[model samples]
Target: MTLLAVQVLMWIVVGAAATGFASWLAHRSYRRFLRKSRGPVSKSLGRGDVPTKLDTLIDPLEAQFPCQSGLATLLDNADAFAARALSAAQAGRSLDLMYYIWRTDVTGWLLLDALVAAADRGVRVRLLLDDVNVQGFDPAFLALTQHPQIEVRLFNPTRNRGHVVRRTFEMLLGLARFNRRMHGKLWIADGRLAIIGGRNIADTYFATLDADTRNSVDADMLLVGPKVDAVAALFDSYWNLGLSMPILALWPGFKLNRTAFRHRLARHVGSAPSRHYLARTLDSRTPEAVLAGRLHWTDKVQLLADPPDKAYGNHSAAWMSTAIADILTNAQSEVRLITPYFVPGQAGISGLTALAARGVKISLLTNALAATDMLLVYGAYRRYRGALLAAGGSIHEFSPLPKNGRKRDMLHSKVFVIDGRQAIVGSLNFDLRSAFTNTELGLLFEHPTLVADITGMIDALSAPDQAYTVSRPDHALQWTVARPGLPKLMYVEPEASKLQRAISWLVGLLPIQAYL
Candidate 1:
């Protein structure tokens, strides 16, 4: 080789070595900090015998159900938020909350204020959040810990707490560990009532986002019965896991002014929009309806959860996905699945084809390429779309446009209804990530009424105006848009531009399906 080429190659090798060494050093520093700042592990479990208003209200209902679980579906965004806020407001003993994302938006603040008010009323509050999204809110979290009645913990936190670049570097260095996140969403009030499902603590999930921004159509379940104990147990297992670290230990130096925080919360609560939203939420009277025994009661409720060890890459024990697969495998007649991201690998496709061979009908509703937020996941899903369609399965892709005067552009609920007799609802998306990578939780029940309710929701969302039907005929793919007076057909991904389709095609060539 020429002298100049040799010199340039040597410089490139040296630069790469330097970069690797720097990253290693940074990771080492983070490890040392974690060891030095580790706090005492939590010993608190879910309070079961606490005498609270929730118990007074729900005890009689439970007695009437008698070993059965009572569930109220929160299909409307406003009612979902209202159920949570009202539950928290009425908790007289303890409140436990776990989520993957808790935005600091209008609705987020309102719920936080509710929790704070509950704490002030002598209710013990425990907040467990995944560290992946709480990078910029350390100060507020730490301040929350200042309340004697409240505690804050982060699941699988990163060592770098300063900037996004540093956190990204840490994640890249420890990709395997960082990839296994806590995706379960649960809210337990006084260990007697709970809410579990796909909605997160954010304005978009609650449909309070601005018109220009897209909102999510999600689902959560208001649970009251013997099954709540299982939900609380799940929360305690995750809350007391070694992977959960207290926020105070992570950011000991950062502090927000307590009085200032209170003032800010009060100001927001007094705002006109907050007043209007809160009024609407209260007017829903969800908690009151639940106390009035207006819920689907059944004794066939089962809790599906991935063990806390799954976060440490242990998939040996029975997983929630396996249980769900078993339910699907035992389907007698029909199955309906609604998921935001549908990257069904070979195994999933094979399972569906097997069901189809048995003369069982299968219907699926997932995000269209234009509606999906993750383009890479969409690319992977497209690979299996044709196979699923050819296997005698009906597929409907959600449209991003407004539907039924509601500004819903994204489908975020994870639901499965089987045989028109049973249903599973929670945060388990039918994808590789949810199946093997992340921890998920859900409620499976054999109540025909609840199953029918979820089935109705699926039917409405898959309507022609709201979604496009995908079919594979004559050895080609087609999307049939049957909107009112706007019937159309397309061969490529509907509503997607040429550049977007090209990018999805390019992404499909990469071997990153496992991450999606």
Candidate 2:
């Protein structure tokens, strides 16, 4: 054989060996991470325990405001923030909070301080946060876990732990595992009062809480009565399950001293900005009224939650979306949907089309291209805009922040109202991710009063000032937008820049529809 041929063969063999070794190393690392799983533990709410601390504060309030069954009050974005703070402060026994994103911003610190105070006062606090958004907030979480009464866990956490660089590499290697996420948002205080819906712990979500209108519009339900217990049960199921792991266990480098951690948190809480925000929150008198059981309640509320295994591609555990689909399918008169991301896959499109064909007045409200935070999701959703509009349904896209507001505002609400009598409010967005790859939670209310309230809110949001009507006129798509107390204007369907439209077009060409 020729010397050149032998040299070429040798180089090819060396390249193959290196590739095989690298693949093996990645697989080995993944297995090592999986081996740390501790399986499920038998933790529960410790039912029937005598409550000396909680009863002292809650019992009298319950007596003062009694409900026939479950009572639910619709809390707009700002009011919901006040309610959560109040619940944490008034808690005697426990506080359980689970959310998809708990940003380490002003709002996050304010709530964290409240929880820490509750824990310091002997109130057991359990926080279950999703692993996807915890990249930059590792120190905050590690410090939080140092408190004796506070326990922190991340649901389906990344094996790379808090490091964003390593987590990105792991995601590239483990696409399937990284794709699924925990999308539920919940807050349960004293195991007696619960708040469930779309608001996460972020400055953007609670923009109105600090009298800041520069955030997204979200909704949550303040629930009491027997339903709180059911929501607690859902929390337990995720907390004790094998998929969740303690933050300390996942990140071995988190060795901050407990005393120093507490002091640091206290110092930050006592800072000027935090103290000012706290004073304002307290001055609102909203907390006082909430603790006194002044919220209006309803009689019937059905809790819908997706199991943690939904992140493992388990379709059966996607109960929130399933229930929502069933509700739309059974609608008699009208179906109104308000969601931030609306990527109606073939099944969703068909279902809604069938509903519209049955003479049901179907209306959809979602984010416009200029207002959406996710471009790929908007790309997938825009493909169906014409089809849905052609099927005798109305589609309203939220406008970007008006020049009068502080910053750009987006529509982050997930709501469904049917027949003016039944409504759903929760964290289940009408997108493929929420339907197939994320755990979600929501409440179905059949009370006429609450449904009417939601219906009215929907009417207000659907006004021309808040959203633009997307219509296909003269064989082309156009958007009609109206500013607050101003004349209406028209534009193209996307209302996006040329480069953005080009990127969106490229994303649309990919064959990952189910995942998008």
Candidate 3:
């Protein structure tokens, strides 16, 4: 309580306030600059002026299916990568891609090379990426925007573009704006074909990494029909959003070294893993099969997408979750839900329990603690286990182990099957984030073949050896693993270490479920 001490404390408080005010002012100015310097709005080349190769290939299918969309499910990792690569190779007019994550790894490099190759063949390429994970890849993206046939944009980018610490600080300061990300994934080629699903551009996603590494078990649907025009329109909406800032405008003085970037990408092609993956991708017959009019044609395809305004805290614009809820509400026989992260709030639990009470067989599949990448989300999910089980719902947790000689570390596919009649395949996870915080996309179709194929895959993944079944028998939670010799039951989370369990328990006590 001395005068000197009080003066020192006052000065310290003043200095802190001044520093905070300066930071806030800088962030506000940066936001204003981004808004004023956004790139011009551009729309997709809906039905291109010229006849593209894709047009020649899909025109026959269009004639046969009439108003239906040609759909092919991509379950294998190699096939998913092949669909994108081969489609890009065949793209003659324009290619529009939007993703939440596009890594700078092996498969990522290969895909970028494919995009560059398509650009070389006079294909107009537009890439819109969520800026959350685009850190440390700016040089490559900058080089891409230099190409005459290519344009790159980032959604909800940070003001600080250099150091990770500064970027993190900026994100923390603008948490409200930065937290709402564009989580949808779509790839449209020539306005004739589109790939929509949960797979992002990465080595793990395509299984092009080392055998020891854990790969994502994902799914995508390749569509070659009139419905692709709708997909293109959706891409145009996101591309033209005010939040989509052109990379060139963000870094005005950054010079592009196209030769150097091309060389860097070329080196990846020669690597053993890249070469092996490229061979498999090139050998895939998916593109040819689509071109040959061999696909499941369905006229009941519906595009479920959240508007770009969702990123601006517009929860009313979130229609994907609402549509999915309606599907769940109308379920007649059975429901199958699959996602990597599953943190169903009280409302989801209540709705699901109500469905179960109506004799609807509810089966849920999600990543086990060891198989999941997000430990905190897994912890949040654990809180709802008992309620779901009490409602007579069966929960299957995917294990991070090799299933039938294939290694899968996580279940990255988000799917929902209703009454064995209709299915949804897309990036919308059944979580609070997907429901309220982030934008998502999906295809709701009633094709018997596609629905059966998806349900079959779900059945395979839910088998005893591949996943662990959780039960609350005798008022205690236990995990049952149906091994070859005998069934094993454990009280704690399967395959998770003691420290991990402790951390998850601690995380569950936090009030951060809204962000999960």
**Candidate 3, residues 1-516: lDDT per residue as tens digits?**
999999999999999898778678766876688779899888888565678778878887689778888898988888788788888988899999999999888888889999999999999999999998888888888998899999999998886788779877777667778899999999999988888999999888887657665789999888878888889999999999888999888787889677888888889877887888787666656667634434798888989999888888876734789989988999999999999998878888889999999999998999988788899998898788888999899999998466556555789999999999999999999888998889999999988888989999999999987899999998789999875554498888877788889888888888788897
TM-score of 2: 0.88
Residue pairs clashing in model 2 are 71-297, 71-298, 72-298
**lDDT for predicted candidate 1 compared with the true structure:** 0.85
If both were scored by TM-score, which would come out higher, candidate 1 or candidate 3? 3
Cα lDDT for residue 32, candidate 1: 70
Instruction: List TM-score per model, in order.
Output: 0.92, 0.88, 0.93
Each prediction's RMSD over C-alphas, in Å, is 2.8, 4.1, 2.9
Off by over 4 Å in 3: 1-27, 284-286, 290-294, 403-408, 484-487
Q: Which parts of model 1 are misplaced by more than 4 Å?
A: 1-50, 284-286, 290-293, 403-408, 484-487
User: Whose lDDT is higher: candidate 1's or candidate 2's?
Assistant: 1
User: lDDT per residue, candidate 2, 1-516, as tens digits?
Assistant: 999999999999998897667657876776666556543363435535667444565566567656633445545555667788877877777889999999877768889989999998988889999888886788889889878888898887777754668777767666777778888999988887788888989878865334444578788888767677789889998887666788887767668887876787778777776777667656666544655454555566789888777766666824778878887888998999999888878899999999999999889999887788888888788677787888889988886545454666788989999888888999988888788888899998887777877778777777876778888766567777665554355555445687777777777677666686
Judging by TM-score, tell me the better candidate of 1 and 2: 1
Q: How many steric overlaps does candidate 1 have? A: 0
TM-score-sorted candidate list, best first: 3, 1, 2
Question: Worst 10-residue stretch by lDDT in candidate 2?
Answer: 38-47
- Candidate 1, residues 39-90, lDDT tens digits: the string is 5655434546655778778877777768888888888898888888888878
* Local lDDT at 39 for model 3: 90
lDDT of each: 0.85, 0.77, 0.87
If ranked by lDDT, best first, what sequence of candidates would result? 3, 1, 2
